[model samples]
Target: MTKLMKAVVVPAVKAAWEVRQRPVPEPGPGEVLVRVHACGICGTDLWMAHGVLSFREFPLLMGHEGVGEVVALGAGVTERKIGDRVGLPMMQKRCGACGFCREEHPDSFVTAGNCAGPTLTGVNVDGALAEYAVAGVGGTVLLPNGISYEDAAPTVCAGYTTWAGIRRADARPGARVAVVGLGGIGHFAIQFARAAGYHVIAVTRPGKHELARELGAADVVTDGAVLKEIGGADVVLHTSSSHAAAIDAMTGLRPWGKLVLMGLSEDEMILPALSLTTHSHQIIGSAHNGLEYLAEALDIVARGQVRPMIELFPLERADEAYRKVADGEVRFKAVITL
Candidate 1:
């Protein structure tokens, strides 16, 4: 008989989450079976739950920011071994024959929107909101030691995306880096920017100023125009799910500065051509970017340079956790612990 494990599943679109028993999946070729210790609930998971994302497969098992130890390895898998701690990010597998994958440009797979490959974890296929999950070897990252499963779980997606945004900014030393939306991703942006030697400025709504400062933000402001009055930002990392917020944050970017957008908004964002060209500003869209970036993000967290603030929920209370995440009640990130 196949082993059974408890998993959080959605039977239909916008349905309430149910913790049900699912057969533990076996690892296929070039894959590893991870006994999941923790998984973070991301905005993408919430979007998928509501059928906001393009993929609409039913009975969704939604979780991408997962971390655990490799319990078994499939045939031809040598890079990962049993007992190795690892993280499963959003992009599980890409078509190796595609131009993006052929060139090892994982970033393009997301930005160019041309990936002809397996669907994303938690988006189309069953994900890690369970006792076990399988991940392609190429898409998994070995988690560094010294970081708990809870802390490392959020780094798989939230930390990785924010770190990629910071890298996309490529700001000079001591530059003013402003982070928009002090949520899960934005909080990591502030810490990573500070670690990268940039002066961090957090742009967020009221009541979050103190939290921003606590996360290494040198300054905190309620509006983007306030940043302009404070000499402008050399780089702005936009992590809000609101395109309007991104537009407002762009106002704070100095001439020749770059604005890195790592958020997803349902509505379209309008950019003024004249203002964009006149300012000589560049807009970069970043996602998980690469496994290398994920490794770096985990390493940073492991080294104590960055810390993840997460609320933990047991497997039985997964529904409550999902509700809190959907309701925006999680202070930073919510991680389900097995």
Candidate 2:
């Protein structure tokens, strides 16, 4: 018998979504069917729905972050059993025969980005907006102790993004780091930097000063105005769509320092190349992270070092959630429960 489950579907661009019934997916070869608990709304979801990003097909089941339990495993899958708690992340799934997959170094992420989310899966493939989802066993993370679905959801994206930027910075112990745009990624950045022994200076508009401090920022400032006061930082991580801010991140870095840009929004990014060249600092843009760094980041969360702040809503309230996110009213991240 075919099982029909509720799914949040985006039927078209610039149109309201419909909650329709989708047949529960069967686990294919090397795949597992999971009963999804929570899936967070990401910035990419917002952009794709509103025509800000136009690379995806419509009528999409758009979500990447999911925490759930395994219900069934497909052929050739014997490692994990039914009812195992795990997290399904949005990552690249490269074919093992590809050059990228074969070159999985410690510095590189997992070899599974080819079929990943954002640009690929969720946007391209059916994602976790439904009550049940199917994910590959290769890129999934089995959860550690005491990690809840709501909490673990954000780590799949926001946490990994922060980890990528921080690691790319190669921040030394006791060094000062600045996190620009204190939203989902920014909140995690402050916590990760503080826990990693860096003095975190969180930069946002004035409206977020108190919230920034509450998230463990050593200092908070209005974007670019008060931000310049803390000159010559060891590293600056940009999680904003602002093109000018991308340039500022580079100039803010100390000589030989690092500027990491994690947010690649639709806005055209224009940077002053001469200034970047003169500083001798490097500006690097990182896309998504892999399992090894994600596992280490999860360890940090398990040890109570880093946490994500989120606003929750049920699956039925997705439109309202979208409004709040589109208006920038969401404090950190927003998630729709199934």
Candidate 3:
């Protein structure tokens, strides 16, 4: 009993996406059909479209982040039912039986698409740009007060990235924290740093200094070197993927400071070997987090501590939204509404 629904499809790599009517998917055992409320235009999505990343097949329904309502429930699912507002993040499902899952290594992401899950969704699965999507019950997050589905949508990825950055820092009260690139990840990083009780310094592109300051940077500086001049901090989180920015950020650290790379960077990163070989600095690549951090992110947003900036667009207008994100026309995050 497949119903008809509208979805965005990329028929091939490096191909333009087109809107198509797809059959509304039914939930299998342990699955649920979500009526997408909003889907965010992420950097990874842009990269995938541009061939910076590729896997599986094209002509696939692709969406990784969205806020939706649980319109149908599969067998064995009891906690959620029809009309439950929820979020489906990038990690649709991780293998609970994997060693990584056992060790609770947040980096051990074993998704079904990597397994046998619907690769036709977003990036190999039918994603949120569609009127309806099928997702595992495990990865769906129920939205709480203080977050509209529109606002909560970006947090599915952006918020989690910032949370992972903060966790990597082992941030404590009064620690000096610097966040580079105040875009989606950067904006949330500042708020997370504040919540962690750190002295927040924002580093962004020269064009975003004013925006950075407004977001709670004690001050915003385009020059990362000035970080060392001010004696630096215990943690510097990199949310921008620019290689030059990463290099400059390394030099800004105080001795033994931590640099957590959290953003999407397609560019091959080159760092000064001396920084790692000579100094006792901690440099960690912050990957997307597990359910633990996802819950934490939801909690923060529910409590109104971390708010994701989002713009809404009809799902049909996703290409326009993508162009805006790529062209830097969107000030914060842009979401496609179904």
- Choose the strongest candidate by TM-score: 1
lDDT of 3 at 104: 45
lDDT of each: 0.85, 0.76, 0.76
**Every model's TM-score:** 0.95, 0.90, 0.90
lDDT of 1: 0.85
| Residue range 251-310, candidate 1, lDDT tens digits | 888999888888777879998577689999898877866677788888999999999889
| Model 2 residue pairs with clashes | 91-116, 92-112, 92-113, 93-112, 93-113, 93-114, 94-112
Residue 137, model 1: lDDT of 88
Query: How much does candidate 3 score in TM-score?
Result: 0.90
- lDDT string for model 2 (1-338, tens) is 35999888988886776789999999898888888888888888887898777665787788888778888898998877898987777762545555554555432333333423222346667788789988777647788887778888888777877886787677788998888887778789889989899888877777788988987888876655455667647888888767576566555566777778887566777766776678777777775655766777777887788777889989898888878887888877888787
User: Against the hidden true structure, what lDDT does model 2 obtain?
Assistant: 0.76
**Candidate 3 regions with alpha-carbon error over 4 angstroms:** 95-121
RMSD of each: 1.8, 2.8, 2.7
| RMSD to native, candidate 1 | 1.8
Q: Which ten residues in a row have the lowest lDDT in candidate 3?
A: 112-121
